[model samples]
Target: MDDLTAPTGREEALRAMPHPDGTAPRALVLGATGYLGGRLVPRLLGGGYSVRVLARDAQRVAAFDWGSRVDVVEGDATDEAAMGEAVRDVDVLYYLVHSMGAGKGFEAADRAAATTVAAAAAAASVGRIVYLGGLHPDGVPLSPHLRSRVEVGRILLDSGVPTLVLQAGVVIGSGSASFEMVRHLTEVLPYMPAPKWVRNRIQPIAVRDVLHYLLGAARVSADISQAVDIGGPDVLRYGQMMNGYALEAGLRQRAIAALPVLTPRLASHWVNLVTPIPRRVAMPLVESLQNECIVKDSAIDALIPPPEGGRTPYRTAVGLALRRAEVDEIETSWQDADVLGVPSDPLPNDPEWAGQVVFTDVRTAHTSASQESLWRVIQGIGGERGWYSNPLLWAIRGWMDKLVGGVGLRRGRRHRDRLLVGDAVDFWRVEAIEPGSLLRLRAEMRVPGKAWLELRARPDADGSRYDQRAVFFPLGLAGRLYWLAVLPFHGFIFAGMARSITAAAEAADAQAGTG
Candidate 1:
């Protein structure tokens, strides 16, 4: 092996030149909208790197707080021309793109994309290419997803670029795919008839620690270029990870009965039937669980030292992730990924169809309270503070949703009294919010139709007028039937909700007046 410090080909000039600031290196992140990539940008910026992100659609990351702080170039990595444009003049290129959940032929797609990215980086004279890949045991058949990850790393390394591959197991963090699987499985099932793969050893690392390693990768001596395995201090079975999550969530210890007869296909279907994860995404994850993913080398520790306090324990990581969820401080979510083959449209209220059946129940009420006071009560709608009206009915609805594999009410608001464009509120996601005027929530519960709840407040002659609307776009006869079935509840739930919000606002106004 040759020292990575000796630059070869086009990288010679790039390595010799210093950044304009003569401080930190310039980095370009490929998948800025992804769970890990989204989190990595902030850490890189905080580390004083001039960060640039390349995304297929820049709008996907427009809501990120650091969006304005970094340079964004919109392009797809699979396109040679786009890749060339995105990889230009960067000291380090982070390749975080993967095609795991994209249905059939994802492996080939990943290979093609990696080839294009590597060729473009080599052409653009990128000094180093940092890639994050999955850790799998050798001498065994690898799952399609993990195999694709490894292939991508190989492609980058063979491109004559100084590529540093960091292979990791399950990443524990809020809104991560693996962590969500553990969370949903533990929270929903008390007695799980799991497959034999549940006993496979896995070393899960905290997302915070992953970010630390990524930041450290930028400053590592250029003489090191090889694959490094990273993991937390503890190595536990997949089943134990679930048990640890349950403990952190304050749930009772679960009973796991390992059944050898259950295959990966059956396990995927079971996961689809129980958790919010769909069949497509769960299938690959279930398939990959059969391989042991524990770390075999500690070479990464020599390059990037561990966090000051130390590696986070599994239980502590779970608790921290849950705390972020409780406080509505999550920066990104698995739902943010467009790989689920679901609609990514932010607002579904387009009225372009001339002939379509749209059902809506709109109600309005006038209150003596000011707009500001009412807005406060409207934003604080879900979570521990149950729905303002018909608490029993809401609980029954949530229970029914849970029975049908929907998100239910367990995913409470990320904040107690604030709403953002992508924030999850119970079974609804906040679609839009205007400070003193409007808040719209889109339904995420399993339904035969698209639904939204829009609330608006405006200044009236005397005080303020509150308008509430429940809009549903039915799919077919089944959707119509579903709407008709829930029609009775709407009258009771929506009507009472309008009155409740008004009363609360009026009470607040009165209290303010007295004060």
Candidate 2:
């Protein structure tokens, strides 16, 4: 090549580029609230980068504990104006948006979004564009999902923007849709009869390791605009992955019998039946399984060396995912509102109908206060009494639940003087009541899973310690959604319930002393 057309000293230029001294480099992460983006944002912040997020819901973006370290803007990636704003004055732009929501024209939507992002990055003169794509088997008929992932990468590459594309297959993590689907199916089903795609080879990556690569890619030289395939150390077929998951999750031994009659279209429905992933998301994933997802090269390993202990194995990944699931079982419940449909009025509170367990504790203290006086204070729990604490948050949740066709706090108590089975108690229903000793109520709100409320007054060393507890057990995919979505407010509501019960008991004692 002639000197005039020769490549410049890109390496020297990168070396000469300014560093952020003690401060972190500013990064703009589009779709920062998504599954991959969500995981990536925290790691970037930990690496000392001032991160910015662009998402549709400002509330959802704010919900993340990015704290004061990150900035969030509500913007759509496909819109030119919004995309330009999101990419402006950023060291690196992470394109993590994927249009997998099953509408009629998702493919076109996916291409348009990519094109818009690429054009926006080029126009804004962003330093580099980092994208994650899917690995597809060459020389084979590609499914629409895999084809669109590849097409999205091409759209960015053709835009003349320096792009670092990392192609990967299944990502194993606690909340990851793909990982959850695999976990639920393996745990719930004993013997497996799956589609022909069960034999297809796949390379799964741990979510932590995937986050590692993404963070490393952001700080690398802007000139390293190459498509790198990333995978875990192990390469196994879908059947093997299922076997490992079953073993890790403590399920009985399972055997897969591949059948020719099962197609991708049929497999999606089957996955929907067994896993928490809905048909809208399951269909695309099932279709992509038809193509082999084995990594073509180990270039990413060389770029960002694996940890000193070596990369996590597929079995280890399954173990970690299951452990996370167990840890997250409490504090939230998963339930999909769409799947449960609209709850009917006068819903039954039977344990068989609700699928919940109730625990109660009752104790008597040697106090001068009469039982009648104490019961009066307990009966008046909602409305003016307010929750034990965090009244504003409880009101907000009750309002939201009411808007969603649930029995909100407006119900109050059926009869404050007495309680019985199936009697309404504010937003709760009396599932069972043992006179003044114990009371159990089932939640009558729209939730991902079954929920319950229990009240018991027991004597303590000082006086009587009233114990009020709320418990939730999830149903399926929807149930998990319900739990995750509501967990943040749990501490506030639960603490309030405890304080209110204690205060109510004290007030009753004071009233009895006055009488």
Predicted structure with the largest TM-score when compared to the true one: 1
Q: What's the lDDT for all of these models?
A: 0.80, 0.66
RMSD of candidates 1 onward, in order: 6.5, 14.9
lDDT score at residue 98, model 1, on the 0-100 scale: 85
Pairs with steric clashes in candidate 1: 328-414
Models 1 onward score TM values of 0.81, 0.63
lDDT by residue (tens digit), candidate 2, 196-269: 88898899987766766676676566567788898889998888888888778777667889999998767776
* Model 1 TM: 0.81
Root mean square deviation (Cα) for candidate 2: 14.9
Candidate 1: list runs displaced more than 4 Å: 1-24, 55-60, 74-85, 99-116, 158-160, 174-177, 180-192, 221-225, 242-255, 268-283, 322-339, 346-357, 386-408, 445-451, 472-489, 510-515
**lDDT score for candidate 1 against the true structure:** 0.80
Tens-digit lDDT track of model 1 for 1-515:
11111113212122223477686677999888777888878767755678888876664556677988888887777888877877777899999888856878888888999999989998998989999998889889998888999899999988888888999888888777788889989888889999999898999998877876776677667777788998888899999999999888999889998999988878877886666665566777898889888999888878877765677788888888888776667767665654533334554545653487888899899999999998988888888876788989998888677655566776566557766666677788777788789998888777897888999989997889999998888889999999999999998899999999999999999999999
What is candidate 2's CA lDDT for residue 512? 63
Least well predicted 10-residue stretch by lDDT in candidate 1: 1-10
